[model samples]
Target: MSTTQNERLRGLLEPLVGAQGLDLEEIEVSQAGRRRVLRVVVDSDAGVDLDTVADVSRAISAKLDETDAMGEGEYVLEVGSPGADRPLTEHRHYVRATGRLAKLQLHEGGELVARILTVDDEGLDLEVPGVKGRKPTARRVGFGDIAKARVEVEFNRKNKQDELEQEEEEA
Candidate 1:
């Protein structure tokens, strides 16, 4: 699909996610087997839940049905999180990934796995997550050349904090 079409799809899906308190990580359209698959990747500060996914799926499916955005034939709709393997690519992506560990794939063929020390217009500061030898190699990767990057879903204590806050609210 054209870039414009892809962006349009993001625009269309954003509100649906926002209303349901989820971040629309990305909306991808690609072929799965002989059919088209519209993958709606979602997440939230509280972590996404099944009910949220079902609600999002129903809402987006309705919008797609109304607009016929997929065009011709039937397409499978899959609503999911970006999973632990996907990389963050944009500024908003970085914000969403605050306090997470990430693997950076440089275009020059190298990898840097670090905690997102910080993010700014200059670049991302990745604290090399290991011993003294690595020394938190926070090299400046231009906004370009980041081939593929993603946050790793390691068990973090803050996840418990988030859960507690959610429970407090629900109570």
Candidate 2:
């Protein structure tokens, strides 16, 4: 039930996001008593900001008002970026994290923590963890075992941001 509502909400917001040159990354909808709170997460190659968020939120609210999309109930709208803790799923995410560290959780409960080397049809190639007094190991993670992965953002260094910058320059 909740999933369907959230999908419908995503369906309603996608056009608005497209019109504003943003990519719809995720959408979350929850109910508190009689009020519905809709959180829409959007992103782009360059990222998102407060003004864009405000613009998206207003667009969604207006569209909902015209269509009564929430079905006669008041809904609060929130629009946001994916944040620093963005998950790595799509090939592009791995591509973005090239040379940056990541932690991958395998479906079978195995863990791989290392820098992203590459991502392709063959799947991801990552530098694996090693024990004390030993050099780190590298591993090729077939797509099947990857349950979840996220970039380990290094705040002091500019590696993560550099990835985005490199992408933009290539573009």
Candidate 3:
């Protein structure tokens, strides 16, 4: 899509999305075979569910139907949340990622995978796991120091229930 079209779409959809209590993370229009695809990524600190996505999709579809913003082309609308691996580009992203593991690349030069402990206006407090069974260390990283960051998926991470059960067993 053209830059102007994209901007127009953003302007048209952002208010709709905000009204529904979701942040408009992205808007993309792409070609897939003979049809165009419009993908809208929405998110919130509390996370997004399928039902919310469905509602948002219906609203977006209706809004598009009521307007010529799409320029008369057949397009499929896909509304969803950002995947677990989506890059953390905003402070709110980091805030929502609290207690999750993230791989951060520093602007000055290094990279590290750490669990996000807390997020404030200026930076993040991370717990960098140590090597060879060593204790994790606390580190502070300002938002500006991060060149890039993304949540890391952990298949074996224990949930709160599992941890609670383990503690009960030990007790």
Candidate 4:
């Protein structure tokens, strides 16, 4: 799809999605076989639930139906939340990823995988896990210093506070 079409669609759908208390993270149109797929990625500070996705999907579908935005063709509308593996491009993205481990590519050089501590307008504080059983260290990284960043998924991770709370409840 053309960039103009994507921008137009973004302009058309952003307000509708925002009205439902979600940020429209991305909008892309691509061809799949004989049909086109219009994927809309949305998110919120509280995260998105299936019910909210359904509601936003309905609203977007209705709005598109009223307008000839997608043109005279068969298109699929897929509205969903941003996945864990999505890049942290925007400040809000980094903010949403607070408390998660991120793999960052530094603009100057080098890569660092650290757990995000906090996010601000200028930069973020990260807790760099030490090597070889050493103590974890803290560091600050400015947004401009980061060339690319993605959240790292920990499948076997457990929170100490959560474990303690569970033990207390069990006792």
- Residue 123 lDDT in model 2? 80
Task: State which candidate, 2 or 3, has the greater TM-score.
Answer: 3
Q: Write the per-residue lDDT of candidate 4 for residues 44-147, one digit (tens) a residue.
A: 99999999999999999999999999999999999999997889999999999999999999999999999999999999999999999999999999999999
Q: What Cα-based lDDT does every candidate model obtain?
A: 0.79, 0.80, 0.96, 0.95
TM-score of each: 0.67, 0.76, 0.94, 0.93
Per-residue lDDT of model 3, residues 1-171, tens digit only: 899999999999999999999999999999999899999999988999999999999999999999999888799999999998989999899999999999999999999999999999999999999999999999999999999999999999998999999999999
Which regions of candidate 4 fall more than 4 Å away from where they truly are? 162-171
* lDDT, model 2: 0.80
| Candidate 1 Cα deviation (angstroms), residue 96 | 3.1
lDDT of 2 by residue, 1-171 (tens): 377776787788898998999988888778878897877888876678889888887887789888866787787778898867689877766776777788889899977778778878768878765778788887888777889999876777655688899899999
Please give me the total number of clashing residue pairs in predicted model 1: 3
- lDDT: the better of candidates 1 and 2: 2
Model 3 TM-score is 0.94
Q: Which model, 1 or 2, shows the larger TM-score?
A: 2
Backbone clashes in each candidate structure, one number apiece?
Answer: 3, 0, 0, 0
Inter-residue clash pairs, candidate 3: none
